[model samples]
Target chain A: MESIRLFCPATVANISCGFDVLGLCLDTIGDEMTITKTAQKGIQITRITGADLPLDVTQNVAGIAAQAFLEQLGTDQGFAIEIHKKIKAGSGIGSSAASAAGAVFGLNALCGNPFTNKELISFAMKGEALASGCEHADNVAPALLGGFTLIRGYEPLDVIALPVPSELYVTVIHPQIALKTAEMRAVLAPEIPLKNAIAQWGNLGGFIAGLYTEDYNLMQRSLSDKIVEPVRSPFIPGFDKIKETALQNGALGAGISGSGPSIFTLNKGIKTAKKVAFAIAENYTETGIPFEVYTSPINKSGVRIINR
Target chain B: MESIRLFCPATVANISCGFDVLGLCLDTIGDEMTITKTAQKGIQITRITGADLPLDVTQNVAGIAAQAFLEQLGTDQGFAIEIHKKIKAGSGIGSSAASAAGAVFGLNALCGNPFTNKELISFAMKGEALASGCEHADNVAPALLGGFTLIRGYEPLDVIALPVPSELYVTVIHPQIALKTAEMRAVLAPEIPLKNAIAQWGNLGGFIAGLYTEDYNLMQRSLSDKIVEPVRSPFIPGFDKIKETALQNGALGAGISGSGPSIFTLNKGIKTAKKVAFAIAENYTETGIPFEVYTSPINKSGVRIINR
Candidate 1:
């Protein structure tokens, strides 16, 4: 087949205790892209929908990802992708990564699936790096591989797809306000206290154990952010109150999702997820700020071919 | 049931990436202690063996642990303990922790296990605090509860016992050279760079995931000390060469066992564990330095009563 259509779901990264290292994909809210072969001997962005992002082939996330992957393939065969995004940009929900990972994933299928998942992630990171001046696999890894993920290291690029508890439900509340990723990262201290670093690693270990063993209480206890959120929460308004309400309303634990403006609560069931969404919505709805909430079980299959 | 005979196993704290928050118990080496109910109305250190540890109830690790426990229990019943140490002190193999944890484990069992594991760890920390000028539960928690463990938080004393892979093996080599724990800790920097801390946490998350999923390659990849070992490894003689030899000779990964001098390597089977031990031992024996080696599977049952 010379053409493929795919859906790459949104991702929630930096899961509180696991800043920049852990992430989970969502079942809803994604970017759909169609990759088609063209007579032209180069990769290009044919169309972009739902938001006014860059349209130039060299400047777009999808275009960059496609160009990188096709270069790796060493092929003169031409390809063009049309993207329809449902996830909002700069929402701390890996919206940009959805476009990047989706293009690579869809293009790989059109090229007969020559590359591995890790390679696809490598190609996809070019898009994120071009946009943010850094390469982060936390969002794109899960968005491509699905489920819970741990980007173990970067020197050799270790990425592992971790097990996700079947009962886990995610509720993401995205406030309309945009928090630039660069500015969100700039708020963090360059050096962390040794004690705090130790605590963070401990929580990360326990959190991973909870995911594999399906220990809900352990996961809740391990959901603390002793490092990242404390430093960056000031950028997101009403962060503490929404988190407290989410935790009090039967949600297991809550924290700022990804970077800022989007807060997420984890729960044991969909009902609790909906309850948390309403409770968190109560904090933002009356303030005349436009917001979006998405509830989903942990996404088991990340980027998939929704249409052939 | 006036007296009890129990053994507390040696432990390897700082499990590479975990720093002060992760550890595991070893089956081969330990401190054997017999705790007896006495007619006297106080805790006492009656007999000590192997190393010249302080015997005073206030200054001794075992005595401090027992005193703290009896005080918290608030009972008029008195207790006396006799310790026979097989693990070497100042060797980076948790010899002191064996005494401290053994005292609490034996006394609690003699008292019909009144306190929970967390309480036992709390009681045990007093012993370490009195000896080291700080309270650390990495070694004691795993020694008391067995298997791999994560001390997620310290303010409220949160400890979680993690699962160990059935096929995992530990090889510990203790060189006769003495490097005090205080000196070892002194070598470490007070603060860690944010990038290094991120890498450490990432490895820790992957390590825990590998444990639960029984992924050996991931565990081997994750067994990296991005924080402590890099700073403290200089204190241990032939550290790099020995670790390189072990890794080359079928060991999964190798690092300083606890603080200094002693080096531990993890592998899949007893044969490889033996091979790695010999390979590492070759590095020390040729230098005319006295060293002891112990190999065992991951201890599932930590402190246990031999003759109940």
Candidate 2:
């Protein structure tokens, strides 16, 4: 049987107010999954790529989603898998999502495209449950379908493609330090002050208004997170300085992406994008930490099929 | 000097999550103020027309605003004022704002128009402070400017006229019951749960996006209030039915206007506007409450000087 290849872009989840609801697909970063059908009636062990990939197909992110899919389909057909782990694992960039979404997307093609995009997203989210220890669709949705998306409702997985302004550019800076996702989750306060919550709503409203109106200035004024960032920023060194310098340099807004070690800045234009990338790089350079800077437009296209 | 007569439209303040920030100027209801300059040097508001007019000019809604405007101009010109109140007082339709804004607007014309529209709003807000026992620009800005206005910041009084969609029509039902603004303020929770706050923010964001994109469906889904409405709605008779009927009759969104008694619905077209009005009227009829319904488009032009 012929092998099928699937590409999944890196995603930025928990975009400010849209915690566990909004996610954006990136243009330059992600992981890849390739699946080749086999004559055997059961799944085979696979080789992992890039970082030390997870063994125990049942416990593995991709393997778990595939198992769920196979159980749902009641199919005995087996397949060999290969993962090109391009994105660093646990970089706060939807690393596990890339693997999960890629596998579902790759297998759908391998099985002659039995399910729809919506079905693939749910099956993929099952894998996220294994990775995060709970059901979460933030990363998988955008990894499967690009651009700015809103999981307005999740019981049936109501996904919406919201309007993204053309002037928007995202600059992600990943510090070389390792911050585990579970550790990042522990730092967040279970309860937030009421006044701060109202302020958050105000900013979130303005931010959404900014998206629809392309009001970059409103986005700049409204890009604040009192509930999450203040608590999480302490773990990431120079978080305040990076945010201030990025805004002062040219970025519209800056904040920690998902759980940190990675900081993201939103720029208004190409020129501002370059300046934001440079400023972020300089911040990491001054701190004596090697960092990766990503400059990409909001990838409107989420998942791409490179080969048939 | 010739008396300058101006009409300032009534407004709805704290449009859901935009508390202390959003207001919309409406037609068919307001205070008609006539201001005439005299040779006397001291600011004296000689007369007022509205019933139960406060005789103490220092604290009078229109009189204080007139005084504030003169003090800012470095001249105390005594002015005789008369306000024909078309909008009933304490109707949750910006009664005080109509008076305050009318005074500033009327005085600006009588004083040879020394202040800009923005300047008048600040003076009007001072009058709002005297009337409502607090300094707020939500009602004043829209009353002075005559449009959908956002009072972004108050120190300098940053007012922005939000772009109004063409197909929008407002159905206002004033149910002839008064809920004191202060009492309404008292009922709001001083401490809100973060989870509720996040839901409010998501709704607010979606609402703003709907306004900009003219996505009526999104706006409908996003107009819910988790904090204010639950407590305040119980004060108004038939509040739930009015909302349910209006939406069923074609309103995009409906909510308690300002404090209580007065409810407003947003509809897509004239047909829906009439339907919403009739539905609200039917609900009021069933409840044995005499109500007045005002059907108007989004009033982009706020204060108009007619027969100056």
Candidate 3:
């Protein structure tokens, strides 16, 4: 093959009650990576796009993923990686995950689909750990495989594919402020209350059940997080107002995307999607935060190449 | 109304991983309670069969619920409660809840439907709290109103009626041994490992999703509980064998019912239900434990007046 162009969709990890366990891939917004093979011994410089991404191979997420991929495969063959970042960084939208997943997925195909999707997810999560200082597969797995995904256990990475209903629409809003992943992690308490923990599990159970059964009401009721969202929402301006407005408009539930700065609402359909997007946009306008709105259907298909 | 006779179905409270949150009402087997207005100053109970039940108005399970009902309504007209027990006590099958729910439901109708179902459930749970020392609404809610139920929160007691798929079949095996609720609670550690907690939540999510969507595979995968089951399974004889046999005989999932001695299996159809029941019986027979099996569907209508 001459070259392969791969797109890895943005994901909302933890997904309200599903902290570090559940996630879903959103269509229409993500990062793209182009991989090309060469007979040379060393990896070549990569083209970078969207919001002035780092060109240094060590600092660039896509480059690190490519290096990790080659190191894991014990391959000396040179490869050229081009990163076209469509999803904004520091937006709580799995921007780094998209690049890592895209690179791993792209390189896997470029090197002859050597690993399973689960393996690629694990490999890409290393890049996430490098970026975020902690390894979590919720974003990486969903970005790679799509749909409703669960990472039950990390070692050997038990990735279970949860059924995603067709009626679900995601409205994502990215405010112009950068929330560093490390800082986000720092603000979160290491230990959560036992009561909150129980309630969290209860909601998570209902949420997963909603995913499998497509019970919209249960999904709505279960899409609540007392642990992370309560602490993280205050950091984002108009987070509470935007979520309330989105829900009032038509969204079933809304919460901070991944960590913070980016907020997302899970809505009923295309109309609700539009309404939710408008609601978030309205909040951002009032708050004087520059924002972009994305209304997309949940992409069940994760990291795959459009042009190979 | 001269008199009302209702069948209050058996229920599984705590639902393994769900613990005080989820419950399901059974169709085929339950306790029958009859309430009639009388010219007495307080409630009177007559337990015809089942366990050595209390008959004093203050001490009786049904009588306490009857008292709560009257107090909540600000009336002191006496009622005669006749409980025809079909679900035996110490069966891990909500025998007390059936009595409590039946008394509240049957008396509510006899008193011209004095309170809503939610209010009646709350009144009945006081009786359950008197019996078990905790205000658990799991069994009472489902016993009063059939189908899968969630007690999301219990300040005012937010009861969510979950969707029950038509294909779900329940096979319940009641071993002739008693597992006290207090002992069962004591058996579980106050604190669990964070990893196990995550797994429990994932499984709970999967189980709930299974209930709504009827995803058999997800249900099976998510049915494995590391926390409650491991800690409490040893209390029930032949739990391991019965669970294994039930799953082997085409059960989607199987676990100890409530506090234990009763084990139930979720199956797809009558065939699987019968097979599951037979498997449990066979496993128990080998262990020399006399067990009773009931194959039933999800009872959509709970606490019905079977006679008047």
Candidate 4:
């Protein structure tokens, strides 16, 4: 294929009780990108629309990730990329991850699929670092491999693709406030109580098990964050009321999505998810902060080809 | 049934990354107990053999568990209990849990099972508190429910039974040394580094995912302890060498069983488990400490009737 148009998914990271390690893909929200082979031997960001982002090869997440992929592949083949963003920057819903994962994914596909989707994560992580100031896989992994992704470890880059329940739906509301990942990370303490840590891991285990069994109630019970949410939620306007309203309106569980200004809830069906979206939207209207609410099914396929 | 004789399986708690929350039951290593309904109006420890333990109802773990069960049942009918112990107390192999769980299990059977195995965990925990100075359900949950268990929360006592791989085997080495759980707990700081906590939960989520999928490689990678093992392993002599030998001999993973003095390794089959057990035994013999090693399959039935 001379050119590939791809749909790169937005992801929800820092899931409740799964902070820093777990994330899932979304079906309805993403960025569209096209990668075309060029005669010149280097990466290029030819165009971007719908968002103000750097176009420099060194500064762009997609450019950085594409550079890392080609460098590893030892290819002189150049690629020109264009991104049409739909997910907002700094929305805590893996905006940069979609671009990064999409670049590597499209490149691998055009390069005769030299790398598996799992193999593409590290290359994507390089771009992720440019955006988050750290080489984190929580967002990039799910955006690459789809479904629920558990970052088992980072040193060797072990990422596991977890099973997704058939009926799981997500409701995400981005309050359009700028919450930098670095700034939000600085608010967390370097140390945590051992008891709370135990509770956190326990709930994580339960949540994973619930996903495999499709037990919504167990998932609800396990979807709690004791360590990170309490400190970061205060920064987001009306975080408490939004979460409480979501739960009351039939969300299986609700919490601050990623580092806040955005909140998410998992529901069993689309009907309840939309209800939760409407209720949360109504509740947040009082805060006088403009926000976007999205209701989507869990995306089984991460990055996909849109057109050829 | 007027009288019942049962086998209460031994359990291994504090499973590597699952510290303070995960555990599994054993098939061969356990205790035998007999409980008989009597005309008397109070619980009694009728006889004890194979281990020196108090026969007093209030002081004995079995008695405390039985009393808890009876009080919850609101029964005035008395029962005579006798325990034939095989698992040594303070072995970090859930010896106390065997007795505690066995008491409630037998009483429930005689009383037509007023409480389920999951429900019996709380009653068994009452007895466990006397042994560990804290009410912990890690061991008792697995011992009562049979197979692997996760203590998701302590406030409302949510214990989840996880799937056990059919080929999974366990090897445990009990170094006959006095290491109290409370003392071992003291060696740990009240707080832990947030980075390590993140690594811990990541591995825990991976391990649970591995169990559900039966991926041995994933299990091996995930069965690691970062927070507790470093500080507590020193208390167990030949800890590093034993773990290395077990891993070298094809054991999936190895770590301290509970608090200290006992170490356990998981293997795919009985042959590998026995090989790992022999390797660990040889490695520990140099310490000149008397130790007993046992290899067994995963117990599916927590406590079962032997005779009635």
Residues A1-308, candidate 4: write the lDDT tens digits. 29999999999997899999999999999999999999999899999999999999899999999999999999999999999999899998999999999999999999999999999999999999999889999999999999999998987889999999999999999998888889999999999999999999999999999999999999999999999999999889888998999999999998877776778899999999999999999888998889999999999989999888
lDDT of 1 by residue, B1-308 (tens): 38988888999988788888889999978889988999998888889889787778988998898889989898898888899998877877788788899998888888888987667999899898876779999889999889998998887788888889988999988888978788878888878899999999999888888887789999999999878888888877788888899999988899888786888899998999999888877777887788888898889878888876
Q: For candidate 3, what is the TM-score? A: 0.81
Runs in model 4 lying further than 4 Å from the true structure: none
DockQ of 1: 0.86
TM-score of each: 0.97, 0.87, 0.81, 0.99
Q: In candidate 3 chain B, what residue range of length 10 has the lowest lDDT sum? A: B188-197
- CA error at residue B271 for candidate 1, angstroms: 1.0
- TM-score: which is higher, 1 or 2? 1
Among all candidates shown, the one with the greatest DockQ: 4
Error of 2 at B119 (Å): 5.3
lDDT of 4 at A174: 94
- Summarize candidate 2's per-residue lDDT along B186-247 as a digit string, tens digits: 88777776656666665665666667777788777777777778888899898899989988
The regions of model 2 sitting more than 4 angstroms off are: A1-6, A14-22, A35-45, A55-58, A63-81, A104-124, A151-159, A180-183, A286-290, B17-20, B41-46, B70-80, B107-120, B145-147, B150-160
- Full candidate order by lDDT, most accurate first: 4, 1, 3, 2
Per-residue C-alpha lDDT of model 3 across residues B167-248, encoded as one tens digit per residue: 8889998888878889988886766665667777776766666666667776677667677788889988878888888888
DockQ of each: 0.86, 0.35, 0.31, 0.95
Give the top-scoring candidate (lDDT): 4
Error of 4 at A1 (Å): 8.2
Evaluated at residue A8, the lDDT of candidate 2 is 78
Error of 2 at A103 (Å): 4.0
Q: Considering only N, C-alpha and C atoms within 3 Å, which residue pairs clash in candidate 4?
A: none
Question: Any residue pairs clashing in model 3, and if so which?
Answer: A205-B204, A205-B205, A209-B208, A209-B209, A213-B213
